[model samples]
Target: MNSTDSRASAYTTLSRDSVHEVEIKRSRFITYLFRVESEAQAREHIAALRKTHFDARHHCSAFILGPDRMIQRSNDDGEPSGTAGIPMLEALAKRDTGHGTDLSDVLAVCVRYFGGIKLGAGGLVRAYSDSVSQALEHSTLHVRQRLRIFTLPAPHALAARWENELRAAGYQLEPSVWEAAHAVLHIGIDDTEHDAGQLAAFTAALTSGAGRLQPFDTKWVDLP
Candidate 1:
């Protein structure tokens, strides 16, 4: 892949849990998605679903976690070996969040309600993958960016205007705080992105050469 595509495929996660269902030959496959920050959360979600869908025959699941997308786990949950959870996991792995990143911190579970018919291994795989894919269609995605938190000092007189204008120009800003004579504007910038020159020029023009932007910390921010 090119550098642009490679960068875009870095990290992404689900904005919320989503649900979608499908039927094949009367066999019902209900796919559920959950946003989980850790393995404990994922396990809790799976347990909750087990209680809610008590009659479900199988509750196959898969999960991927961390900012680096380093953790992954899958469970067959009583389904035929390699037929349900593996396909569900692969389905999530193949998903693109459309923000140049792979999906993470999410779990997918497929609850199967037997419909008096049996699907072979291949059919089960297709059903599980397709069910998760369908659920992802209704899921919202968030982009995760490693960014530098900055404090920009603005004249109190221009604080409101600058807040509106800077945000409108695509800068993510936190609330402004009055400190003596200036309004300190908290903002975040993706230092690794190719917007340094543009951001510098914009800040200079906005503050009329008086803006002092300083980095406070580095963190990962989620963008919808």
Candidate 2:
């Protein structure tokens, strides 16, 4: 696959809502939290909770996105210097990469409820980091695959045979269409170089070297 395709192959969080909570005790100090993929989603959850518990002390948040780690932002809220947001982001970075598939985006938030106890700067960092770490341990994750899109045109009569041959050769074929007297097939190929050779062979066999294969672009796709 091309560089653009490879760069996009990183895994990302599923577009769904999930919440995880943890209780931390540092001499009467308590912290409750939730993590989501996007800042907007995280903010939505925080907004509802903040409305209900308007008196809570702090709500710290962080998020990372794209295969290249393109987007990264964190907010300490109203905690001490280097206490909440930075530690929370660090915790998420140190998290097991497997939880997010190969190339995935992740976001973490730690909501703090001061129990009338000051945990100090160091204690606050540890508490915030641990909250996210614990939540990731109980969450579900997915793996993504890179797919190359190829468009091929063959004679209408040979379309079925072409698709069957390609599938039997370990290729993923999409719906075939008949345009005039030609059959157009769309295929998805993995990153493996072997797929190119396989496609060439299949095309030669199906159209007797008369058909053409064109590869368009590559993108990250959910695994079957």
Residues 1-224, model 2: lDDT tens digits: 34444454445453434556555563322233343456676677667766765766776777776666667777888888788888877776666756344323666656666666677899888888877777666666555667777889877777888888888877887788779978889888876567666777777777788878888777676554
lDDT of 1 by residue, 1-224 (tens): 23353333237888877889999989899999998989999999999999999999999999998866678999999988999999999999999667777888899989999998888889999999999988998888887776667788888889999889989998888778899988999876775445555677788899889888776776777766
Q: Identify the runs in model 2 with alpha carbons over 4 angstroms from their true place.
A: 1-8, 26-49, 99-103, 191-198, 205-207
Q: Rate the local accuracy (lDDT) of all candidates.
A: 0.85, 0.68
Most accurate candidate by TM-score: 1
Q: For model 1, which pairs clash? A: 8-100, 8-101, 9-100
lDDT of 2 at 51: 72
Name the lDDT of candidate 1.
0.85
Q: What TM-score fits each model?
A: 0.83, 0.77
lDDT of 1 at 203: 84
Write out the backbone clash pairs for model 2: 10-103, 11-103, 11-104, 12-104
Candidate 1's C-alpha runs over 4 A off are 1-10, 158-165, 205-210, 219-224
